[model samples]
Target chain A: MAHILLIDDDAGLVDANKLVLEAKGHEVSVAYTGDDAWKLLEKRRPDLLVMDVMMEEFTSGFELARDVSIKFPDMPVLMLTGVQEHMRSDWKFDEDKDADWLPVRKFLAKPIPPTKLAEEIEAALKAAKEKKGKRPS
Target chain B: MAVSEKLKVIVCDDEPKMCSAIKIILDGFRPEVRTLGVEAELEVSLVSTGEELLTRMETDPADLVLLDYKLPGISGMDILGRFSEEKRETAVIIMTAYANIETAIQATRLGSFDFLAKPCTPEEVRYTVKKAAHHLIVSRHARLLAQEKKRIRFQFISVLAHELKAPINTFDAYLDVMRDMTLGKDMTAYAGIIAKCSERTDGMRKMIADLLDLTRIESGQFRRAPAALEVAGALAAAAEGVAAEAARRGIKLETEGAGLLVEADPSEVGMILNNLFTNAVKYNRDGGLVRASAAADGGKVRITVEDTGIGMEKKDAARLFSEFVRIKNRATIGIPGSGLGLAIARKLALQAGGDIEVESEPGKGSRFTLSLPAPGSIDLKAA
Candidate 1:
């Protein structure tokens, strides 16, 4: 079981996703605003984070993800959005840029199937675990 | 009979006599309009302040406003500024007794529809109002046309994005699947999937080709080379292209009533049939039956494709011939298609002096019928 944080401005989507993720045995915490998400991050870190593109302030999620990755580089971030293509174009996917940059582990377009979401979450968790194991003790 | 409609007007002036004179002129004009059997009833409202004029506008919208240039709290130009800011559709005609040419120019800059000098004739007032009404009508229509064009452009961009993304994403997914050996070295199964993916890619290519072709045809860049051909052979070949896909899904694809001849470009006819057959297989239920047939009827050859798949609702069926409209179906998700097949096919058929018809219901599936002129009826050699 994994503890996942979902940050999005859409209240209904947050509730629905929380229900689905919890039902799959993952403990899900949701933040409808970017400030609330930042507070939650300071308190406790989750194994994975799912974020939306547009929040109260435009591109708030993108900014928060970058900050969180700098503070806690180990945590895997899964970015989800309706405008995946738009985001993909804006963020120019590349790994060699900067360490402060939040390397988005995965991206799922909105209205994603529950099965696909679960699969992606599991894959990301497993990869994180293997990378930790490879690190010097 | 056409002249009884009320002429709604708003009069803004600090002076009571100016308002009274304008009201008297309009009231007298109303009776003359009625006598001429014109639908013009004059309804006027008087306001002393610009604020009152703006507030009254919310409840009682007028067709025209007679605004005084000199007023108490706010001038006529100030009211015009408010009108411009509020984006009011009503036309404003500036009224100035001590007409300073400068104030009239300022009023014009502030968007006054027209300017009226003091002690103006009732004839001038009547003619000005009539011209303002005509101007309003023409401007409203132009705005509507501009808005419609913007809406169409937005729709085209949305469709273009979907059309481009679907094929590219499908190609990427298929390439990933092939590279990973997700499906084992069972060459037959591997070959089948690859073939299906390639066919879908081909469909995308053809849709792009058709889009370009239609653009060319509409721009008068394309000329047809029509020929007398066997309709059955062309349709059969198109059906064969999608036969493997149907078979894979356990659907029965059959052709009947062969040996029909038509006067058309064989390649174009084949393309139309290919699109129809692809749609039939793409939208059909697993184990569905698709039948393609052609027959000579009256002076034309009728080719029909009937499928037992997920049918379209009446609303969708109505727009089937329109460009870039895909029937929303659960089974069609993740499948790559531009939704241009039927539109292109219809255009091709029309160019060949033919027409297409569709009969469909939400759950029962659909039948597309194409009617084309019989072979040798039209001069195919020069086409």
Candidate 2:
């Protein structure tokens, strides 16, 4: 339905997500780091961005998302994080509190099932289109 | 409290009769005092004024001081201040004629163990001295236990890094290879499972790297390969490595001071500079600047990293070098960090006969200065 760009340091996770998105009949591009994702953004823009919070640097994905929001305003971002459990902090994404800093349309913890991941992709894409329509044209 | 040892109790009373009376009462309380780890025979030192007490303390510091407030030259209040400043573990029991609530509060604030009125009975003196001795033993044990806990924690982190990170890294790499395999339709069903495994392994990998970094610095491994190297060369090498990333962010990276030399392992020097540059780039505002400069002065090579980035609060800076502590706030929320970088860097600097200093303002910028002993400047034989 849409072209999705996935940025993650974990090659296997990127592959798995790519497979699920492709099976759902969407084109997917994978980037192994924030730097790679930025370089790719130079040549082409995807319908949506899916990224892990920690990559080559722990906050790389978050910074990349902020950059995207500034440069590619209409592009939606979905964040995947794997640090909460390891940090032993009871952290959850609160839209109102985190919206300004996180700037992501959707946040997902790691290990999402393929079916659920596809659903999230579809939901994110639909929301992005709605947001774009609401913007003064 | 151990019953077999002896306690050295110093009694400072201007009156000889008063001292003799307290000594007689202490002799009777010997069995009770010995229970607080004092020897069966009490080693008692009797002094008449603060001057005599100070001289006696120099020769043989007592476990407990039974002090008189009205001394000839230095008042007991002054001696208390001196003892607190010296951080002497010796407990002081002030015997005062002005044993009002105010004097007691003043004495206690000066760290007196207890206060006794001038006409206090032999029994009162004996009981107060015994309690002071016991308090000393308990606090001494607590101080030792606190030190022991710190040592154990350092050992635990070192062991975890050394034992756990390698295998996890190997397993993570293998998982990546598996994901790369073109197994077509059959592998689709297991894609989610493979991805989950990969993410878990990757988390372990990051943790292990941080752990190893912490252990290497804590265990004095940085000093393992010491050699004379150019400080500016190490800075250039580190800057070159991160140049691409800095450019991608539209940040400027500049380095100067070409020939300053220091006695340190090149790799360790590289690591210290790399960490500083990475932080300067990572923490800076978009399109901000990072400048690194090195110089030799007073037999030390000083390298400074200055950045136009989000600076930190002075209070936060105090705890920055402690493990597992990261600066937490909105500006830092999106920035990921292990919180061990500065701590490890400081340890490495120490091992390399150097140190790191930081200067920052909330929004202006930050400057980190690392200094290492210049080659031939420090006496190797003495070290």
Candidate 3:
């Protein structure tokens, strides 16, 4: 089980996601804004970060993601956004762009199902472990 | 200066011959008024009284007026005062046979463009008309430009307001579902419903925030807090941001070439980096690789992101950086994007004396290179 940090402004959604993530046997902590997320980050490094794109400030998650990757290179981020629903488009996330800009591993549309969230979290942890194996000694 | 081609010049006098003489001189004399690729010509209208001139003005305002101080049924001075009160654009040239220093001073005080005595030379009539017409054209152009700016601003605000419909509608739908709840009274059984409600509301909150950010950027009010920082920190921060998403998709996100210093606000630079990095992750193949590496190219420092994912056609890539444009493709149809990310990224990059460049091909991978001004190199303007 991996440690997860969930940052979102909605208390209800945070509680729901926490319940779902914990049910999958992982440790979870939550913050409601980018500032609070940073304060939480100062205390511990989570294995993965689950974030909302628009919170307190638009693109705040993107900012937090940037800070996390720089401060904790090993932590992975899963971005949940409603941006797609409002600005519908045929656009795929491209990683070849600087990691600093598109720092999240996945851009999942919000109102996501609990099963899918848990599954993605599991997949992320597995990938992290595999990445550690491939790193240079 | 060329006179306005359809310039209307009104001549008011109780004496028909006086009006006729002025009309004939103006009709033959073309006023020189500067215009933007448009010729100007004087079209004269003769009125026997101040009331007649004012009535005609109500329907078709003159660009310039030639009025006699004495008239029946309302003095020319009263008409001039009315024009002043109404703030008409028509430039006035006062003409009276009883011209005196006091009357001339009064016409000037009332904002008349020119003052002339009766039986004035035709040359004097022509020159005054020319000066007044030129002033009219310049003010007209200024008004047009201001109106156009207001119209564009209104359109932008409307589009932003329209965008609010999505979240509100989604919330409406969520409420409808809640109204028909079949589960027990305990809220745990309604966790999903509660979650959905929060999601919609959160979406609205986010949309509003993005709108505010766009406004700040466009208004030129976004102040920068530039500091000397390491490019590696930005890279690592970005990598950390997408680590989960990349890992979930089995995509490899690796950052190389650490310790390159750049003069930038970490958050601003981080924003650019996060956008590109997120794009790389979201568009990649299930097991593809995304590599972000920083290097110095001449006097500039660049962080290049290369992805082995489903790329784009050159045509689609060309439109990617424009505001509200999103590439429609089979591979991207299910993806959720604000469509403003790249546009915002490009703006912030340019403001920082840098730019984000893209090279992609269908079925192949894509490469994005972001270049920033190196510290002590390239004069950074206050943005």
Candidate 4:
């Protein structure tokens, strides 16, 4: 089972996602705010980070993702957002916004299903493993 | 809707006396006009700087902003530029003690509602404010009407594209099959070429159909006929429809949740499943797997199509369901598509009181799930 970090501001949504991930036999860590998520990352890095775009402040998740990527380039981030289409088409994340930020690995819109989430996590883990193999140890 | 409520006004002038003079004039005219005139609840707040005016507008979004032409930090024209760029729909009246015709023309160009000379009368302030409010109402309504018209035009174009392309695509596919030994000729040498052409043509056909469906639904022409359907049976048929194409690509198509039931339009549901499956196969790596599964959960059934294909970038994945939007990185240019399939499927799912979702990553794979109400369970009357 993979260790996953799920960050979101909605308490009920976080709880629902935790239950779903746990039921699938994955170890899940929940963070209700971006600060908590940053603190968690400082301790032990998760296998994958599932975060929401709109948080307590504007672009909180985006800023956190940028910091994480800067510190640890290997970690993969999966962004969840309701305004995915708007962000993708209209917003341009350039060097001025965040220097170390790489494109997120996956994006799932709000009201996602448990099975699809599980599938994405599994696929991402597999891809990470393949990348690790190719890297010079 | 009472007329006694005072007209809230915000006055920004470096000279405090000028603001007081304007307020006094407005207060004097309040009692004289009673019938066919607004009972002026004229509350004026005076600010000395343009920055303060901007802050107040951001905080309260006042009904009207009376701005002085000259200010310490930012000029009235600069404020007007920012307000217009932000699309703030507030009535703005420019006031200047030293008035020039060029300044008045420039203020009007910058979208100032009206230009006023300083030491003006109370009647003029009242008339300008009233006229500006009326203009605001009319402009807002006009904008709404224009948006409605644009939406209608988008739907019309989508439908027209679909209606024009369907029959042509069908004919193209037939010609492709006939060119090879798949149907009539025993010419085995050109089988590969014929298969590729046919596949591309089929993709185009599906795209046209998607455009047509999107237009119909957006224009309220498409209607949902929810009925009890064997979910497994529908999956089987849709799979069968794409089986030959999958075989051509050496992809495996499998279904797990047969015999389940769902409440939806059979044709629309089938199209949704078919589009997802086809996308999986067409975009997959050689020998990739395409799996379709369904499960019953309380009052709904969840159907999913999972594939090991050339996945998408996160940005592209976000717009996977918007009409006529395709991922530029994953698009195979020679392979024809109108990029309306997922969007149409999403609309259909919503019409059935359900939703469609996707999960994907670059070079990994993708999965699409459809959550729908179970057949024979939904109350048609309430929905």
Candidate that scores best on DockQ: 2
What digit string (tens of lDDT, one per residue) describes model 1 on residues A50-107?
8876564457767887887788888998877656564445644344553346457765
Residue pairs clashing in model 2 are: A59-B336, B5-B38, B5-B39, B6-B38, B6-B39, B7-B38, B7-B39
Off by over 4 Å in 2: A1-137, B1-204, B221-223
Which scores higher on TM-score, 1 or 3?
Answer: 3
User: Model 4 lDDT vs. the true structure?
Assistant: 0.74
Candidates in order, TM-scores: namely 0.53, 0.44, 0.55, 0.43
Q: What C-alpha RMSD separates each model from the true structure?
A: 12.4, 15.2, 17.9, 17.1
Residue-wise C-alpha lDDT for candidate 3, range B151-242, written one tens digit per residue: 98886664565445544544543443344343435667767767666666665675566567777888888878777779888888998999
Give the range where candidate 4 chain B is weakest over 10 consecutive residues by summed lDDT. B176-185
Q: Each candidate: what lDDT? A: 0.76, 0.77, 0.78, 0.74
lDDT, residue B44, candidate 3: 83
Instruction: Report the number of the highest-TM-score candidate.
Output: 3
CAPRI classification of candidate 2:
incorrect
DockQ of 1: 0.04
Best by lDDT: 3
Backbone clash total for model 1 is 8
lDDT of 3: 0.78
Best-first order by TM-score: 3, 1, 2, 4
Considering DockQ, which of the candidate structures 1 and 4 is the better prediction for this target? 1
Ranked by lDDT, top first: 3, 2, 1, 4
Clashing pairs in 1: B2-B39, B3-B38, B3-B39, B3-B40, B4-B39, B5-B39, B225-B383, B226-B383
